[model samples]
Target: MQKPSIPKGTRDFGPAQVARRQHIFNVIRRTFESFGYAPLETPTLENLSVLTGKYGDEGDQLLFKVLNSGDFAKDVTAADLETGSKALLPKVAEKGLRYDLTVPFARYVAMNRGTLTFPFKRYQMQPVWRADRPQRGRYREFYQCDADVVGTDSLLCEAEIVLMMAQVLNGLGLDDFTIKINHRAILDDIHQAVGGVVGQEGSLYVAIDKLDKIGRDGVTQELLARGFSKSAIDRLFELLSVKGTYLEKIHALSEHIRLSIGTDYTGYTDLREVYDILQASGFKQFDRLEFDPTLARGLSYYTGCIFEVKINNVQMGSVSGGGRYDNLTGSFGLPGVSGVGFSFGVDRLYDCLEALDLFTSTAETPTRCLLTHFDAASGRAALPLLAELRAAGIPSELYPDASKLQKQFKYADAKGIPLVIIMGPEEAAAGVVKIKIMQTGVERVLPVGEVVAALTVE
Candidate 1:
């Protein structure tokens, strides 16, 4: 028989792992809600039409398409098969697993535009699939915790996103991180100044976005391979190499863009305003905010400011990222609606937490107290006590099989259950029960009715 196995780039979380993951989710969810973002969810599978062309060429190539139900190839001709997967994909697959929550959210906004309020704010925590090669800190299937606000062009929204990012990361016990900020328009200006091809701006953005991963030489090689002029690549790096504080770098870029384009640099100004807003609001973590000239989030829809976050001293990729999209809804026939958002990489964050040994001791199992018995009669006698404990909102469980005291204690210890209740025949006759604190090994004899109150108080 073939060995059973899960797909590569995916994971099966056991109970303890699930509990730890849930802890991460809970923090993100609570933070998103506290910022006045309502919870929203979209379907796992979205129609190909809705998914295609939204995330640019590279992102589109990473999409995981789902084939049509039976006879997916029944309508395809021999010529279609020979044309390659690209030509045949549409013929066989009409839908695909969502690449990310943001696009599906845009579709949702468009479909419900008439009924919903403007500037709809929502948070979504869901799994998305991709077809890319998976590696460390990168998965084919993973969860993204996102919060977005559509239908507004407020820089305050951008500032709030920065604040929320800091809050969530700090809440999760990660304080040393940087929230890199940039502008797509500024990237465009750099492209134009560097004599980048008019219609090939995406190439520049995609190449520059990998600056952190591949280093300067690598990005330059990619830019040259993509047909960028050597002088152009040098000029692009000249602007990207500017170093200083956030405001200082912003000023330098403004002067460069203004001198090169002979026009006011709105992107730089907007970026400055975001920083100023955060400063004015007394954001204490200004040290964590940075103005990155080369941070072009490769996603095509981002038309305004962009953000990416990296944790310090950890060997991992970005744990969170997102940006402002001016008119993502325009593709869905709802034009002129703007939005800004960010997403936390839950799986990566979990890995970082585990590596750093930051996860606190959380319950591996929900059962707080296990009722032990020596025989079937003793077990039956413990039933009433179990019900009472549960009724009092204490997580209590009964040892189903009559077992030795040592065996029961071992089971409770293995599960991290803290308390064990013993109700043997002798205790039953005495109208009392013994409660053992598993961690302390201290036993207390209490009346049957006092068990619930004692557990509750403890």
Candidate 2:
């Protein structure tokens, strides 16, 4: 017999885990709605053509392609087979699991361009798959909570996204995180400062984005391995090593750009304005916000400012990340629609919260009270009371079987239910019910009519 197993990088969440994850999703959703963003949903699978080439070369390699349903191998040409999987991919597969929500969202906007309003504000919470190797805080299948605003280039859109991120993180009780902001144009300027290869600036930025993970020495070695000249490497490091307050770093970067590129750039000004806006919008009260020049978000779609969120005390990957994409939809036949958005890495954030022991009291159980009885007659008598509790907006469940008393209590305990209701002969005869608090082992006998009021109060 085969042993039961699940694929690596995937997980089966138990009751408690699901409850905590749902709490995270609910907090993010409520925050999205409060900001006037409507909900959106896209399919789990997208056309292979629609997904490829959007997430850059590295991302494209991580996509999980689906095989054609019927006799897929028969259509494979001898020449295609000789050339291997890369050449034969199109012949066998035409659809793939979505790698990220942002790309599918672009496809959705393009397909529905005629019907939707301009400057649409939307949020999506869905699972995305990647063919990535599983590790701590990383998974092959996970959820992304994304909120975006498209059809406008207003910097206020960017400001609103920053504000929304702050609200979502705060709602989740993740207060010790930092929002690191940077601009692709600023990276472009830095690239130019070192006279970087004319057409490879994006590639250079992608490498620089790994500095936080790999450290400065590692980044230097990587740039060297990527064929960066000594002068270019030196200039890039100079900009990266500049240290000061947020404003001071902005000033130093402005001076570095003027000296190295011999031209004026708006990146410094953009960073300053965003900082001021976030300050005026009350973001500072919640978490640290900084102008981090070294933050090079690896996505190829980002056209303007980018944001990466990091939990201060925990050692983990970014908990949230995204930026402005000026022409994502344009690549799919709609031209000139610009947008700004961010996505929370649901798994990583959950791990961070768990490490800090922050999920207690916030993760809500589905069934608040489990109603049990000693026998068939008592179980039948408890039905009306269970209905009353549910009608009164309490999440109450009645154990269907008149199982052994100990077995019923074990079920309630195993489910992490907070309260258990007992309707046995003694309690039924007294016109009262016994309530046990699972955590505290506290017991109380209350009149049948007052049970709902008492549970509701507690």
Candidate 3:
């Protein structure tokens, strides 16, 4: 048989890795809960129809469709198969893995519209799949920790999301990061100023969104290929390259809008108001929140304020991103509900923490102590002690088989259990337990009654 292997862009997290990942999840979950957001979950699989057009053309191509059950091709015509699979996909596939949680969440809300309360706030932590080339910091399968609020149009929801982002990062011990904020309406204003056609701003922003990924020259070349004049391209770049403080950028964009579009733009006003809310709420007390006109966020669904978070001094991509979508639920037959939220890319954030050496020793290795015995009688006698340790909330496990003492010690050392409790025949007879510190190789004998006290010390 061929050797076993996992698919590319997938990972098998070991025990230690799982513990570290749990710590990250715990941080995000606690922050979400503290903000009064309730937990939610959606299935990994959704109908192909529900996912196809939500993301743009490029995003639609990355969906991993599930084949129809047995005899999938039974209905396909000879001409359909001859033409190519793309044309025949509808007949053969009806379901696909969800590419992101936001769309699925929208679908969930729409389906339960009458049963659920208005202004629903929910947080979902789940894996999503994408059929794309995988590389460093990019995965085909990964989890997204998302918290969104629907049924409200207040900008306070947007401001609260920014503050929530700051809270979660600070809780994770990540103080060095930037939260880039922008608005789709402002992008439209820039596009209009640069002579973009009324109905084509979506495609224009999609290309302009790649400015960070591909530099100015690359974006200009793309705009040119899409039939934009060099003059328009230059003006677009000038608007994007405008620099200053958060308010200064807003002012610059406002002046450019007045000169080019000859109209007052609400997007600039909205951006300034969001920034002011953050300042007044003291979000700056913990993290850096800035207005970045170049941050387009690439998603076509975002219709209001957008967010993208990146770690400072690291080469990794944005560890978190999301924005407002005014009509996402309309496609599912629930119209007029507005929602704003953000998602934490848990895997990327994990990598950031690991690269920065921020994971604490106890967080990485969760099991604090191990209890083992030398013989069958000793093992039976040690059971009560193990029970006591567990009841005291100490993470302790007993060696299943009364194995050799050296072998047991080796297992404890390999697993990074800091303390090992040994109850041999002599110790059992004397009603005492010997404790060994794996790191220092130091040993101490304690009476049975004193074992709990020694292990319980913080």
Candidate 4:
């Protein structure tokens, strides 16, 4: 028989792995909830129309489309198939695994616009699927923990997002990551100043977004290949190379844009206002907050601020990122509703935590104590105690068979159960039980009624 196996870019998490992941999720969920965002959930399958066009062209290509259910290609003409997969895709696939949470959330808002409250704040923790090749810290399937606020254009939402990002990272014992911030308007002004073609802005962003992966020389070559003039590329680097503090960089970029394009620097003012808000709120993590002029989040719908996070000293891609979308809802016929949010790449974060040795010891199994018995009578006598232990809110389990003592002890040790109750024939006859501390091998003989309290204290 062929060996059973899971697909590449997917995983089956064991108990320990699940426990560790749950720890990360609990921290993020608590942080999101503390910020007054309620939980929300969306279906795994969304209409292809809803998933596509929100992300950029490259992102659309990464969508995992679901083939239509029966006779999917029955209506297809040979000419349609001959035209290629691109032209024939719509005829066969109508739904796709969601690429991200933001778009579906926008769709939900558009559909329920009449009943939903404005500025709907929600947090969603769910899995998303992409069709990209998988590598270390990059998976075809992963979880994105996202929190978004819609129906407002206020910069306060941006500031709060930064704060929440910091809180979530720090709460997860990640103190050395940088939160990079940029604005789409800033990128647009830079594009215009660099004499970029109007309709080819996506090409510029796609190139610039790879600055970290490919250095300046590589970006210049790419720009040239993409029809950007050398002088434009030179001007682009000059603007991006502005140095000094966040305020200093903002001022310098603002002045350069105002001089080059002869227009007001609204993006600069927005950045300055966000900075002032953080400063007023006594945000002390400025060192961790960076004003990255070259940070262009490649998502198409982002119209205002964009954010990305990277942990220092880790050889991995971004662990979290998101941005402000001014009119994502417009595509769904709910025009002018604005929203901002960020997503934590749970898989990458897990890899980071493992690399940093940040995960504390968590119980692999919820079973706190296992009841071991030598004979059928003792096993029968332990039933009431098992019920009592459970009634006392302690997780307890009983070995099903009249297993050997060593076998039962090994089972408890392997499962990381801290306590094991030995209700042997003698112990049961004496109306007492011996609780073994699995770690230290110390055993205590206690009355049947006191077992719960003893285990509870331990």
Candidate 5:
């Protein structure tokens, strides 16, 4: 017999855990709805073509490929054997588990472009799978609470997303976080400043994005391993240190850029435009917003401003991340339309809550009151009162078995049940009841209406 074990990087959430997770999802979903976003859901499995080549090379490798249902081995070809066609393997194995919400969302918009409204607002709460290593605050199977606005290039989308993120986290009772903002164009300007390569965007950004995880020294080591020059590295370092008001970074870059590239290109000036717009929109109060130049989300599709949110004093991975994609849907022949969105890593967030002890009190008592059934007849007698308590908006559970009174009381006590309404033979015959305070274990005989009025959380 095979030992019962799940694949690595996956998880199984028990009942209480599901409740807490659902609570979090409800907060997010409700907040998204309040912001005029409609809910959207995609299938768990999508055509491999739709998912492939969308999340950059690293992401493509992390997709969980599905095998063809019938006799895939026989479909092998001689030319396929020569080149080792991982890309073409999907033709044999035609479907894949979705890698992320954003890509599938792009596919959806493209397929439904005729029907979708411009600046189509959508909120999707679903489980996304990644075939990656499982570690602290990361998982193979977890939920990405994503809200996106597609078919618009307005940075107003950025501000609204920032506001949405602030609202969601604030509603979750987490006020301590920093939303680090950066622009791909600004990074592009810096990249152009030193040894610009046409297709090096993904490789460059992925390395820079690791700066937080690996530190400056680690980033330099990784870039060197990726073949960056000394002069290029120095210039990129100067580019990264750009901070303060957006104008300051642009000005500083303007001055030092020529040192490496021999011409100070005025590319990052547009970012200052973005900053001015945000500043005018009163964006400063938007949840500890900070200018971080190192935010390079590994997705290739992001074509503009990018942001990441991190909790202060918490040593976890990014709790949320995303940015703009100017032409993602264009890949499917829908040209020039743009979209921007962000994803909240719910699994990492639950860990953050646990690490900070924020959820210490979230393991709510299952029932506020337990309807104690004294015996077979009394159990039968107690059902109406149980129905009445529940009808009165009380969360009450009936102990189905007519167990020993001690055992029933112990069940109520073990569940942290604050109150237990007992219908014993004498009480049932007299049309009275015994309401015991499980916390204090004190019993009081009371009328039925009195029991309902008493259990209200005063």
Candidate 6:
């Protein structure tokens, strides 16, 4: 048999990695909760129809089609196959893995319209699949940390989302980040300023999304190659280079940037705005932010303000991106509702933390105290001690098999357990435990309280 292997664009996170990931998710979840957003989840698979046209043509092509269940090949024929994979799909395929959480959420809201209250706010943490060639930091299967508020067209929601982005980064101990802001209308403004090019309109947003990858020059060349006149490309650049604070826009496009999303007026000024809003309400600490005009997130669906977060020195793609989708619910038959939100790319953020050495020691290895199995009788005697450690709210585990002290210590050290509790014949008899500092190789005899206090001191 061929050697076993997993698919590309996927990963198997070990225990250590899972712990680190959990820490990151907890940070985002906590921040979202503080902002009054509730938690939600959408399924992994959605009807092929629900996903097809929502993400534009390029995104639609990246969808992973799920074949019809059991006896899938019963209807296949050679002639049908000869026409090509696309031609043969109807006989077997009916559903597809979700490309993103947003569309599925739209469907969810529509399905539960009457049962749910208006202006619903929910945050969803779930894995989404995209069938594209993966690269460093980008994966085919990854989790999306999304927070969306629907049922109102409030600029306050947009401003709050901006603040929420800053809060999560600041919470992650990431003080250095930029929240690039853009609006789809601003993109439309640029396109219109380019003298109303015909085919250029459709691909305008897609080309803009490549701003980070190709830079201005490359993007100009791409637009030209795609039938845009050099004049149109130059016009596009003119609009892109108009850099002023989002609050000081020179026109309607600029004014929209300044207007607080989900509100009638702009909130506060710059990155401190989030802090100002939260601090006034008893929350402090915030992250840095920048207003990058070319941040074209959710190109086709996002209707209003958009955002992207990036760690300053790290050389990876965005750690998060999202925007306002005004008519998303309408696509599912609920008209006139607007929502603004953002998503954290958890895996990319994890990789970024690793690269920057920001992931703490605890994040990497969470299990701290390991109770060694000294002997069968000693192991039985040590059970209560383990219970006490756990009762004190410590992540303590017992070595199931009674192994040699050295071997058990080695196992605990490998797993980065900071302290190893040794309860051998002598210690058990004496009602004492030998706490060994696995990192420092310092051993000391202590009572249960003392052991708890020692482990508690980080």
Q: lDDT for each of the candidates?
A: 0.91, 0.87, 0.88, 0.92, 0.80, 0.78
lDDT of 1 by residue, 209-284 (tens): 9998999999999999999988998889998988899999988887887788755678888988998899898899
Query: Where is model 2 poorest over a 10-residue stretch in terms of lDDT?
Result: 281-290
**Across residues 1-458, which tens digit of lDDT does each residue of candidate 3 receive?**
99999999999998888988999999999999988899999998999989989998889999999999999999999999899978799999999999999999999999999988889999999999999899989999999999999999888888888888888888888989998999888888888889988777776887878877888888888888888899998888888888887788788878988888776567777877787787788765423877888888877899999999999967899999999999999999999999999999999999999999998874335678888887778888988988898899998889989789899988888888899988888888888888999899999999999888777885
What's the C-alpha lDDT at position 100 in model 2? 92
The reply for model 4, stretches above 4 Å from the true place, is none
Prediction 1 global C-alpha lDDT: 0.91
Q: Which pairs clash inside model 2?
A: none
lDDT of 5 at 191: 81
Better of 1 and 5 by TM-score: 1
Task: Provide the lowest-lDDT 10-residue window in model 1.
Answer: 257-266
Candidate 5: C-alpha lDDT: 0.80
Better of 4 and 5 by lDDT: 4
Q: Measured by TM-score, how close is model 5 to the native structure? A: 0.90
Better of 2 and 6 by TM-score: 2
**Candidate 4, residues 39-118: lDDT per residue as tens digits?**
99999999998988888889999999999999999889999978998889999999999999999999999999998888
lDDT of 6 by residue, 184-242 (tens): 66566566666656566667778888988988888887787788888878766766676
**Tens digits of per-residue lDDT for model 5, 58-97:** 8888999888888877768777777687635855788999
Of 1 and 3, the candidate ranking higher by lDDT: 1
For candidate 4, give the lDDT.
0.92
Best by lDDT: 4
TM-score of each candidate? 0.98, 0.95, 0.96, 0.97, 0.90, 0.87
lDDT of 3: 0.88
